[model samples]
Target: MLATGLTFVAMNGIVRHLGTGLPAAENAFLRFAFGLPLFLPTLIPALRRGFPRDLWAGFALRGALHCLGVIGWFYAMAHISLAEVTAIGYVNPVLVTIGAALLMGERLSWRRMVAIGVALVGMLIVLRPGLRALGSGHLAQLCAAAMFAASYLIAKRLVERTSPAVAVAMMTATVTLALAPIAAAVWVPPEPWHYRWLLLAAGMGSLGHYFMARAFAVAPMTVTQPVTFLQLIWASLLGTIVFGDQVDLFVILGGGLMIGAVSYITWREAARRSPITPPIDVAKGA
Candidate 1:
């Protein structure tokens, strides 16, 4: 999860440094296009080994959810501070936790609720709804976070029945296909340097997802999730010192609260997950 955060931050930094002149759709397409080669080997095995057809519809739905998230995430990152984007967006884990309990009948204990409550406090610190002005970037971040949570939950169920590598490959390919026409129609001329960054974003995203897959293989969502909140700390530091982004008291306090809440929720979930291994296979190995 920490690795995923850094990769995402780096992807954002690369995209932002590339400037807003780049078309969002085109840039997004290019990233996944570049990612294709890296994923080819993983794809081979998954293709030969298929999931039940019944699961494909779920995969498509989840892919669409994730596609929306990727687009919003790119749009927000290109326009906002990397730290701000990262901080706001990383709350999906908490959302997933709540959603799972309600939807999946996953066991929920008081400890998880307390952890979630504390995390909400942290989010409020960053958002500071009553204290400050809100921007479109904030709105984009919120949407992206929610969509990401929905996508991951879908993926979680899908992973239980399919290979993680296959699930990721399908998402990338589907998103690329979905975005292609839109990107081509609105395409702007990109310099060689622009292409370089686009390619880098693709690599980071694919690698990030790969690491995430591996992490999930080793641990349950509850066990592995808290570590992901660490992304906020990376974002704050990266945004301030590296990007020279100005800091506000509310963001600091709110972000910390959010992290604390998320962390607590994760820790409790980890404790309560029962056995480390699934009575059956916990993961389809990467």
Candidate 2:
């Protein structure tokens, strides 16, 4: 999970570094397109064994949803501070928990409900709609979070029936195809530097997804989700040091609150040996 967070933050930093040089859809498409090769070894073997027909719909759905999320995320990175993007993204886990309960029939305990409520409050603090004008970037991230949550919930189900490698590969392929038309509609030729940076971003993104899938294979999303909040700290430092973006105190405070709430649930689950929330093995390397 720690590896997942670091790799993803590194990818986000690269995307931020690229700024708006390329259209959001094109950038997202290329990220996955370049990363597609990384999964070929896994994909080839899975293809030889014959892809399961039953799982096609699930993969397609996850791919489309993830593509939308990535487009929004790329747009958000260009328009907002890295810390703000990460802070707003904290809502993903909360949305995931709700989806897990409603769609996957996971139990929703009172503690979890309370924790989720607190996390929502933290999100509100970060947005502060009335106090500050909500920009397109903020709204984009909110939509991205919802899409990501749905994609992750579908991934949780898919991983049960397929290897993580195949899941990641198929998702990459599908998203690349899905983004092709959107990217072409507003396509702008990228410079050589753009390709190089996006390639690096692609590698980081592939690694992040692999690490996340491995984590999911061994533990429930709730167990692994909170650990990702650590990225907020990394993103804050990176934004401040590298980008010279001013750190918003509200973002930090709200992110800290959300992290605390989720961390509390993780701790309580481990302490009580809750059936709904299983114990995680951090050393297990997911």
Best by lDDT: 2
Task: Give the best candidate by TM-score.
Answer: 2
TM-scores of the models, in the order given: 0.89, 0.95
lDDT string for model 1 (1-286, tens) is: 7787678767777776765777667787888888988877877777687756777777778767777777777787777787678678757888887887788776667877887787777787777787778787788789889988988777777666666777778778777877788788988988888877788888988888877766655555665667777776777777788778887666777767777776665555557765643543644654
Backbone clash tally (model 2): 0
10 residues in a row with least lDDT, candidate 2? 277-286
Q: lDDT values of the candidates?
A: 0.75, 0.90
lDDT of 2 by residue, 16-67 (tens): 9999889999999999999999999988887788756778889999999999
